[model samples]
Target: MPTSLNDWLRILENRMLYLSSEAAEQVRLSAKEGKCEGLPLRVAALVQEDGSFHYAIGFEDTPKDEDVRFSDKGVDLIVAPASAGNTGRSMYPFEEIDPATLASWLEKGESVRLIDVRSPAEYAQGIIEGGELMPLHLIPLQMPEAKEGEKLVIYCRTGMRSGQACGFLSQQGKDGALNLRGGIVAWAQQGLPISRADKDVSVG
Candidate 1:
């Protein structure tokens, strides 16, 4: 006698393969009670370009030009379509800048805005004194229109949030919003001076 439908489903799951509930049921019902046929299931296995398994899922048909995955021992990730190619627009590689560069730009009285995207409490701890406060959560609503060709610099506590803010600004027609690489932490870590809010506890 063949295994039951439930048993086959369990086997597929145990193997880390995927199957929709409906599809699994169809295979179960079509198989003989005691015996079973290996149903021809279509699947797209997203394997690394090198040769490691990233993820696999059963599909009805083959997809066109799947994303390439790296197979080397280095960090591997599923590169999204928007950031796949070498010259893709979504690829905004970070450009390292020192505190002196920032100070020089400010000294020259350049028409630039330092936008901060950290939380209120984090911002109060220590931030660029003249930087504009625009928390990440309010970027959608509080964002003001950017003038054409305006220069803007965005920063957050550790550079992560500010980078996201820069991306958001980029989408909002602010192409000049450069994210402060390494953020305030990088600035202070380099022995640069900092400014703190007088009422620190009020920020939270």
Candidate 2:
């Protein structure tokens, strides 16, 4: 019954919140603290074009009729379709590697897999050499092609988004995925080389 996009959003946000039993329990505790009892929780992805996620989460006392329903460990939730994501919590390890270490690897000609989780606009400005541009939204689709035992090092403008990507990867059971500490900002500040993405030749 929505007539416009914003109206549609008033009715829904296409995303999923997958919480493990432990994570669900933690959420339960947090909800208790927020005093959001008896109200269904909603997790909205206030994402930006640069593949950064800004979540707007809280209780929804009156969910729209068309809103998708999901329940985990007695914590009711309202979301949209799957594909929109958040792997609530990870049971695997996550770590960040400083810029110096990553630069050293590239200098030594080590076969390090570099994934750039940045928007094309941002990527066009510059990128780490040989880095694959797999924006946050595309990870679920592109990550499957990753090789076994691949040494993946993900990065962004700052360390934050890469850390999120690493955590998401960890949730997928891909162990040993490393985040570039301080991200490209640190790498550039350290005088490590950055390649300008050729709009014509960049991987589609």
Measured by TM-score, the strongest candidate is 2
Q: Write the per-residue lDDT of candidate 2 for residues 1-204, one digit (tens) a residue.
A: 122335446545543345556446645754575577777766444333554333334455555554578787788877632123442331123556788989888888877888888777788889999877877667777663346755789988875456557756766776567878667888999999989886753445
Question: What are the models' TM-scores?
Answer: 0.51, 0.54
> Model 2: runs farther than 4 Å from truth?
1-92, 144-149, 201-204
Residues 146-171, candidate 1: write the lDDT tens digits. 46655677777655556555555555
Candidate 2 lDDT score relative to the true structure: 0.64
lDDT for 155 (candidate 1): 79
- The lDDT of each candidate is 0.50, 0.64
- The Cα error of candidate 1 at residue 45, in Å, is 27
Q: What is the C-alpha RMSD of each candidate to the true structure, in Å?
A: 17.7, 15.9
Looking at model 2, report the run of 10 residues with the lowest lDDT sum.
Answer: 82-91
